[model samples]
Target: MEHYHDRRLVEQTWGSSNAYTGSNYTDYPYFPTLAKQLLPNLRCVQVVEWAPMSDNVYNDGWDLKLKTPDGDGAATAAVASSQLADTSLDCMFVYFDAVDLAGHSSGFSPQNPSYMQALENVDVHVGTVLNALYARPNYANENWLILVITDHGGIGTGHGGITYEERHIWWIGSGSAVAKQQITGPDPGTYNLLGTGIFNQSGVDQAKLKQSPVQADIAVTALHHLIYETGINPETYPFWVGLDGKSWLSQFSGVDKDMERNNIKVFPNPTTGIVTAWFENPTNDHVTATMLDVSGKVVAQHNECSSTNKITLDVSGQPKGMYVLQIKIGEQLLTRKVELK
Candidate 1:
């Protein structure tokens, strides 16, 4: 289990082993750490490692017991309920591994009674957490985005292989921000092989077996809702360009017009100093570019009356952080995020 955390840290950091050394997961830039840095007022909590043999500690700000009790799932639920009651808590990550344990002990198929029972137990625990969330005193005014996801699936009694069952998993998100629609994967032709074998079998175009949602999108969706609810500019954080997925909420609605049309292209996004924006076509209209900090205050501005298709914003003098870039040309307006390292 501890190795699992290490491997995940390595993967998230783009295979940078130097970022995670000697069982220290805090060295990596995790989403929770970034969230706390972005919003000091926001309280992030993590409850993980329900397995008995697991170390049960991955990163800082974890507020649960180190040892799992006999009924670990129920214990996790109790902690989740208690944490959700805290008004200061802005985000909480709870992990329950009873189903995984059951699958490993018995079998990873629906035909296994023990695995099914473990799933049912976890479902009850999830229900308890949801009940506690709804019981919040300020639930009426608060907006929450609840996401449930799994790292991987299993085949027979074990996983970790490149089998289709081990790769194919599901994600469930429910909240005010999430659209009330089910997103499923494209059908892998021939229903006969669906239940009997892996979906990515020979003769099936693996490229066409794409899905509407991805696991990486989970982080982006959470960040999007957090920014929207807190009224913080997305550019305030330097990790947007490094995000591996797009927000699911942005897929159905709230699309940025400037980004949708791709009329302007920003290169070297995570730049150290200078950033360039190339327009699709040259504009004769007067162009004005304003650079704003995290507080929405203008830190720098550029004005160009000459006809050109490119604009450059220099933030070499500014501190290392994220800044918003707004460009106005005639009646057309465009916005971009700039990262200064």
Candidate 2:
């Protein structure tokens, strides 16, 4: 298992080996992506992550994989469409890798005839997948969140870098919970894409929603969705802390509410453990500190008597993930992000 895992690190990349080393990149220990992290642990969760044997979904606890021909979106669509009637399956992910290869080979432009043809083919392929989805026996009863996204866009004949042409992309989400109106002229970053999808599916109080400013905010949003869907409390495992993303949920919700008050401060954030949150004034009011996971589940709580202005929480033993620390002093509630690694 270890050897296969190591070999997959190289095979999964765009090229056979690293340009500099002429060998595979090091297989370092890292946290799983949101889809991989949440789906495997959930009971009856059906996932299909496509790749070779070394990078197979089943190896990571996912249920199935489509044996589509290499870079053949039509083949993938057919297989996925065929299985949509299976009532036992709960969730599905169908990826089309051919378009990416086509984009890289030819310039990724709407004007490019080849590129345009490639997109048209994908549209037809996706139509079939949608047809299968609607054909499902439980379609009328199920709440589905269908998301369409591209990793990145290209500039000229190449891609990468955060240029307007590169960073800018389109995302289309259609489902029962998505907003009917279109978002106009809003420049939401890529990190917010999945979170936006989740919000459209599983709602967060709009009054409490805060747009994230960092790329890592997607991780927090993913965790929030997982909790809402699975009803699993994340406090049992390690905590997750997005590297730079702001809290888009209640933590930010409370922060927005209490920002003007400037009553509390959480220092040594992204700490391994042993966090200290201190309040400025309110000498005679009772205070309470609640540590919550992204899903808003309370992991731990501490109560402080009237005279104390500071409360400490130890998160060393908790799993590594993102958490929200909400501090309530009398009437005001202040919240911040806590990363326990």
Candidate 3:
């Protein structure tokens, strides 16, 4: 589905005040606003603190007050469950802060009873949301990718410093599209020496350390799944470029193979002038082809494509550099990389 609706619900709780109610919450590059503009079908439902309803279709006023972690989680779960049941809702981001509040109020350690209890409570809320997702009437026909992640880990009663406990965090991605393998890095050899209160990685291999996923991967992964499934390249709209993280799904067995099987063949990739693309299967939909520079600026385009399996574009006059060629046949978008030498 090229056009899909998205929802974002963040619970009002401790440690998330800045993100939910701070002055900069509605500032530029604010994700909810940017997403709404980019994805026309987006519908955001924010349960934040004191924020008025957004002017557009972005927010449905659900502003709430500070409450216990469990309470906030329950509220978020209810919103998520309700939104998930709506067939028009394609993607949803639900945030629960009870565990973080517990960690901040008490010590962030296994021995801390409050922290452990908070984790248990959040787990139940997660189950509730997942159950709602699976119970959707179109569940069997939908390809949903569920990702759970935290911003940071804590040390003792607080966090913020670049210690091992404060930096290392967990990420879980589940769904039919997700890989079955675990993503891990080489042991940093800090487990036994954690009691020493030292968090440096002097002897650790930086290359291996880079193997672990970072925070940026979450957005890229979500975008990759959306683009692959919907067959719409957001980059065609001249955005989603210059991303920091690589999609982890590409490393495992999944959509890449499926795409290759139905791949569009483009020859003379390092062409001096004209480039031709052949669709493996015939399509009756109207076709539009566009070529964009590495900076996402459209340089050339062709819109007179007929009901044929092949289309060609001429970029011989453009500067010698790499460019992306996007072919939109009805709602299915196919992309090819071209180089002018």
Error of 2 at 329 (Å): 27
Question: What's model 3's TM-score?
Answer: 0.63
TM-score of each: 0.63, 0.50, 0.63
lDDT of each: 0.62, 0.53, 0.60
Residue pairs with clashing backbones, model 1: none
Query: What tens-digit string does per-residue lDDT give for candidate 2 at 1-341?
Result: 11112222222211122122322222212122333344444422222223542242233333554456655477778778877777866556566666656677888788888777878888888899999999898799976656565545666665544355654556455666555544343344432222222114132222222332222333333343344343322222333322223223333222221133455788778878788998875456788888877555677888888568789987778789888787777765566778887
> Tens-digit lDDT track for model 1 on 1-341?
11223234222222122223344445433445445444446677766654422352364433333443545399888887988898877787777888888888898999998989999999999999999999999988898989888766678877655466765667888976556777765743311122322212453434543345655557656666665533333323343444444466654445551232347788788888788888754548788777777655677888888877788888788888888777777656667778888
Which RMSD does model 1 reach against the true structure? 8.6
User: What CA root-mean-square deviation does each model show from the true structure?
Assistant: 8.6, 11.6, 8.4
- After superposing candidate 1, which stretches have Cα over 4 Å from the reference? 1-28, 50-72, 185-211, 229-239, 252-341
Quote the lDDT for 112 in model 1.
93
Residue 200, candidate 3: how far off, in angstroms? 17
Better by lDDT, candidate 3 or 1: 1
Instruction: Flag clash pairs in model 3.
Output: none
